[model samples]
Target chain A: MSSFLPDILALFFLFSLIIRRLGVNLAFQPATYQLLTYVLLLTIGLKGGQALTSEFTFSLISNSLIVIALGVVLTLVAMLIIHTFSAMNQSDRVTLAAHYGSVSVGTFAVALSYLQLKGVSYEAALNLYVALLELPSILVGLWWLNRNQSSTSLKTIFGHQSLMLLLIGLVIGGLYGDIAEPMVKQLQPLFAVMLALYLIHMGAVAGSKFGEFGSNQLFLICFAIFMPLLAAAIGLGTALLLGLSIGGTTLLMTLAASASYIAVPAVFEQAQPNANVAQALVASLAVTFSFNVIWGIPLYHHIAGVVA
Target chain B: MTLVFSFLTLLMLLAVTLVAQSTGMVVTNYFMLIAALVVYVGWKSRKSVKVSLLKRGRSAA
Candidate 1:
């Protein structure tokens, strides 16, 4: 319990409320989110790439497929659950399913920090996984939303900043040998600070939607809390099958359970405007984001200890 | 955001699969399981999407 940093997640959330209470959108200026998210993605990629100096392999590719598949399975199941629960209408459920199924990079970052504390050596290649995992859910959602229509558009999917920055990091990291340590030293230290900036911006996003929480259907609140646990269960199974070390298992478990508050929303805006964006946004941002940070991280760690 | 989350999921797949193949750490289970999940889920829910669309149609009309 003491290991948890309630203040970090809470602080950004609080900052959001304060700014909202003051009646200003200070964070949106100069597209701070774009810059900050890319930096976070690039640095994470570089650090991760440095970790994987051995360069490409079948296991890395196949495991990534599995992770992506895991995401798809989760998203599809989450959509089913949301619909079955009558959580919201079709539009909202589809959008929300995408959110639930996708991985939260911020949460992953925090989990990585936690793993470092435990002295766990995580796969640097997982950095690429982090970026790549952002896609399948969005594509799944867009496919659902636009199945009736034509042109879901490959450019729309690949053109995203998150995916691109992540690739650049991986490429740079994969190509460079031994220099990763210095790069990691310079970049990784700033992770906490970068995360703070990202969270503050997210807080503003959450803050923007503060009034929108629990307005019509509040069942997603339950979904939000339950998702991490569900993800952990599946992740634990995956970890066991992968034969990952305890720390690796824990990190994988954490990632599996985590929810996306960043990339999925952008896809919704870009491709599926008719889908209920606000419901999905509020549910993920306000509910899962904080839940994972404050309680879910520790909860998943405990689950990992028990299961892994 | 939900879609973007999935997007992240896909990107990670691209990164890891390439590396794992090189390092000889490529586990076939991941490939088999992901394929199975997709195929199974698609089979089970094949009709659900159409049903929902019909429902939406009824509601909309």
Candidate 2:
């Protein structure tokens, strides 16, 4: 996975840029994205479910509780970091905070795939954490959005496809993961291919928006890059506190460094009505997401090597 | 309107069943089948959309 990832990703990213240069129409991209997302998320969830069923323990359950609390705390820290960077409006800060605090499953998937490439075994419960971290930041953001608007609806937060699909994956893994063992063995090679397809689309989407990321002034751009590294530090520290393995520590760091594109926008739109979507998207996708994919993974892996 | 979400629900259930019930090699075999189905449908859908758009442009021109 390690050897092949860089070459294929670079090739795909460069290919996307070439297509953009040639002025080709990519009008079907959003639909393609929906299709890829459906396939990828379901695959991840199903595999995760199977993994979880292999060794379900009380100890793992307790560890998960700690991970959940970590999500809330990280979200607060993300808000604090954003506040420190720029004194944007309260709504904007809270919006950005929630996104930065929440996890990006794609980034997490990249990290896991990277580990798998390296033949490093991470905590399978790591799968559960992506879904677990999805909600708390928004919940925190909602509370931070307004103390008076304190009526938390767990239903609304849980309604997301990302979260629900994962839980379903876990349940499936617990109940019938072993049932599909025969089938899963033959499709193992395609895992990398599926992931590669997803990454190619990632490259195309990010490359198409290449100009938007650069339009920001030097300081804001720097701020966007800096926040994820800081989150990585916090993630690493938290993982150590929990006594997780090197692979698990690296993943936790990636989750910290990653920002949510999927769950956050819908959230802030309703919760903090005055928030700027463009600004948040730029910060999360153009800056943080790019940084993590390009350099953040290696840097986190380095940190794990030293600390873990 | 038969949306993608409806299909997604069924896929997730099937994926869970395959993953949960199977082990190593057999799981991969099943996944290959799933992958073929998704790719074929996605490609076909993409092709049809492009064809329709092209036809619309030609007629308008």
Q: List chain A TM-scores, every candidate, in order.
A: 0.87, 0.88
**Cα lDDT tens digits for candidate 2, A120-176:** 888777888788888888888888767876665666666677777767766776678
Candidate 1 stretches greater than 4 Å from native = A1-30, A55-57, B1-61
| Residue A255 displacement (Å), model 1 | 2.3
- Cα lDDT of model 1 by residue, A108-213, tens digit: 8777766665566766666776776688888888888777889677877778677777888877887885766687678877877777777777766766775775
True contacts kept of each: 0.00, 0.00
Model 2 — TM-score against the truth?
0.75
DockQ for each numbered candidate: 0.02, 0.01
B1-61 in candidate 1: lDDT tens per residue? Answer: 2322333433443344344445554335335433543453354345556887999999999
Cα deviation of A144, candidate 1, in Å = 2.5
